[model samples]
Target: MSTITTIGFDADDTLWQNEQFFRQTEKHFATLLAEHAGGHDIEARLLEAERRNLAHYGFGIKGFTLSMIETALELSGGKVPPNVIREILDVGREMLSHPVETLPHVRETLEELAGAYRLVLITKGDLFDQERKLAQSGLGELFDAVEIVSDKTAATYQRIFTCHGDGPGRSMMVGNSLKSDVVPAIQAGGWGVYVPHDLTWVLEHADEPTAAPRFRRLEHLGELSALIERLGREG
Candidate 1:
């Protein structure tokens, strides 16, 4: 409620339909390896592979596709057919080409807030894929600035908010991930708003921010305007 002036948003589940595509791709991948391993077993191995590959390839479709391939190879003991590899690549291509569907009330909420505050897109992912999503989303112009970073941390939030000339105290971050968007933002001295998504990547999970006075939780993006208005009044 400290007269929040600059607002930041995470792009993936907060604004658009991202995780669904990945989930679909993962399902298809598991089916392809059904002969080699059980669907659930393949899924478990894929998750482990993705976690292990994070440090090496970072995030996004490219890294995920590679992990799926590696998992397939491991599950099949290197006997996986060439055709299966081609299908895996095809799944990645399908994911990359999936339409960017904005979540309910995202545009309306952004439109309401755009004129009153400095709005920034503070998402972390691969450069090319993130950029592609931004371009496809058609909501890019609503953001005053866009940041497609490699990672999200307290220091990262502090630096971004500070560079925006507002510092973290007067800034706020809204998104679905408690780990990447809320906790780090609050730790950096900014207000953090959680807009829960129906689907979240396992790696992005974190405990709710009950200890932070500036933390706010909303059911959806549409409620953001009212929350901000109330915070402003409190300020």
Candidate 2:
């Protein structure tokens, strides 16, 4: 039998279309600020603001919107018109209300694994926004527990796994981010399954843990069930 008794999933690009919306909004934001700054400069400054404000705002559309506003103000020397800020707020509102689009194979994979193991949805973001996405995704019923956290770290995974399953040693965390989803879970002694998403946020990028014995990478979630079975057989 597989040593893994619990499976944790990341919500944002892992289960549904998320970053793409942010990307689209970013383009619109750039267009809105074209008179004030170049696209490349705006993008770089926005990323810097995001990195700097993470501790204060955490993560989600609200934080992202704040970062965009801050970026606009800085790039435009605090002279960006009020209408531009309004447009930015509208963009953020649109993102918050955007329909949740589940990625291919997500539903089927969750359905196949739900009965056999403890499944947890572990994602860090604005609680209201995360909850909204979860409710809209319609995948909430399949998970044994849901965690909307401020961040993902080794201690976070250890605590979650211990609360919801056998523990980190018997758990697996699967997601698109090698930084937030895979690395910390591995550090907590669980299997870290990296599922690459094409539109991953630049901030979430991390070097792959190719040397780790428990590290695994998948093209997509469709391959997850077979990989779990294979791991079980190996054990």
- lDDT tens string, model 2, 60-162? 9999999999999998899989999999999999999999999999999999999899999999999999999999999999999999999999999999999
Deviation of model 2 at 182, angstroms: 0.6
Clashing pairs in 1: none
Model 1 spans > 4 angstroms off: none
- Displacement of the residue 80 alpha carbon in candidate 1, Å: 0.7
Candidate topping lDDT: 2
For residue 19, give model 1's deviation from the true position in Å.
0.6
Q: Give me the overall lDDT of model 1.
A: 0.91
Quote the positional error of residue 125 for candidate 2 in Å.
0.5
lDDT string, candidate 1, 60-88, tens digits? 99999999999989999999999999999
The ten-residue window of minimal lDDT in model 2 covers 1-10
Model 1 clashes, total count:
0
